[model samples]
Target: MKRIILIGRAECGKTTLTQALRGHKLQYHKTQAVNRHDVVIDTPGEYAENRELARALILYSYEADVIALMLSATEDYSLFSPNIAAGATRPVIGIVTQIDQENARPDRAEAWLRLAGCKMVFHVSAFTGDGIEELLTYLDASSAADENV
Candidate 1:
């Protein structure tokens, strides 16, 4: 059992992604809070209260081998990154969520990352189960690839 923490902005599907891994929504609560960091961020992404949550996530990353920093593909990816990293310097994966919507601009998101010089970006849709497996595989490989944790 890996101590992996999924950190992301509000409504970025952090809970939803955990559900997928749990096999279903009902199975989500069956697992211990080990998989989640117990967030208390206020409504709206990156609220002032999120700083506390981000700090917890920061501490959790010390114990976490992999931190999935999720972002909205509809917006710029660079905004929520590095900050969520919280000095872990660990193997962090960038997840761009909510790409299944008709207004979702995955290409624009990818292009924006490229323009910002970020090559380690993964585009995924939690609703349609797209690229979710790849994110998990990346998380698993990150654990084996690094011994720092």
Candidate 2:
């Protein structure tokens, strides 16, 4: 699988998404620092929200095959500005989380991610295991493609 670095604001489900991908039992664990599990790099939301620490994300991105910018469907605003992914050398994608919520507005999240320059977007609910397979399949395919090159 292609390594992925997850970036987003707090409570966007980065840690939960990682657990779902790995088929682990869902538990609430606040990410206080950068964590690596196999091909997934889980980052604290503060890293993205704090300007001074945001540069660390770029450094971490270098070690990843893809940069996944996450956003909660319930969020009213995005921390990322337009074309933020343009700065990333790695392929950038978006993951819209919390779609299982009754009030989720996945379309709105997708729009923001697209505006932020995500090459593609996915809707997922970590709690329900929805869309995890497709994301993993994409990663596997991308990893294969990278190996070819």
Candidate 3:
């Protein structure tokens, strides 16, 4: 499996999505530091929330096969720049979490991610398992493609 580095603001469900992708039961765990699992690198939301720590994410991106930019559908605004992922050497994808939230607006999240230069965006709800399979499928395909190169 290709290793994926997930970056996002606090409470964007990066940890939950990592667990889901690993076939583990969903659990709430605060990531205080970079947590490297078998195929996922979960980072603290503060890394994205604070501009000073943003450099850490760039360094971490170099260690993964893919860079995943996550955003919550309920977010009122995007914390990322329009070209946030433009400097990444690896393929960057977007994931919109909290798709099942009552105030969820996946379209808005997708738009924001697109502006951030994410060519492929996935809208998922970890709680309901919605769109998880497709995300996994994409990851599998990405890994395969990486192996070929």
Candidate 4:
């Protein structure tokens, strides 16, 4: 699969999504540092929240084939600015997490991601395995395409 680096604010379910993609048991494990897996680079929420720390994400992005910007459906505001993906060297996709939440506003979150310049956005619920298969299929196809090149 194409290696992916996930970036987002704290508690946005980046870690959870990582576990889900790996088919591991879904547990609440706070990411304190960068956890490099074969296919995914799981980053701490603070890295995306602090400007200084966010540089670390850019560095890590070099090691990834794709970058994922995560947003929680319940977030009232977006941390990302418009056309943020335009600055990225790699393909940047958006993930709207926690779609199963009672107060989830997936449409609003999708709009924020689109405004941030994500050409592809996915609505996922890690707890329910929703959208997991499709995301995996996408990664698989991307990786396959890269191998062909």
For every model shown, the clashing-pair count is 0, 0, 0, 0
Candidate 1 wrongly placed segments (more than 4 Å) = 26-49, 76-78, 81-86, 110-119, 142-149
Query: Candidate 1: minimum summed lDDT over ten consecutive residues — where?
Result: 40-49
TM-score of each: 0.65, 0.95, 0.93, 0.95
Residue 29 lDDT (model 3): 97
Q: Write the per-residue lDDT of candidate 2 for residues 35-145, one digit (tens) a residue.
A: 999999999999999999999999999999989999999999999899987877888899999999999999999999999998689899999888998899888884445
lDDT: the better of candidates 3 and 4: 4
With candidate 1 superimposed using the best TM-score fit, by how many Å does residue 137's alpha carbon deviate from the native? 2.1
lDDT per residue as tens, model 1, 41-117: 11223431266644555555676655555566766444553343344566555567778877788776665544433
Question: How well is each residue in 89-124 modelled by candidate 4, as lDDT tens digits?
Answer: 888899999999999999999999999999889999
Error of 2 at 112 (Å): 0.1
Please provide the root mean square deviation of candidate 3 (C-alpha atoms, Å): 2.2
Give the range of the ten consecutive residues with the poorest summed lDDT in model 4.
Answer: 140-149
Better of 3 and 4 by TM-score: 4
lDDT of model number 1? 0.55
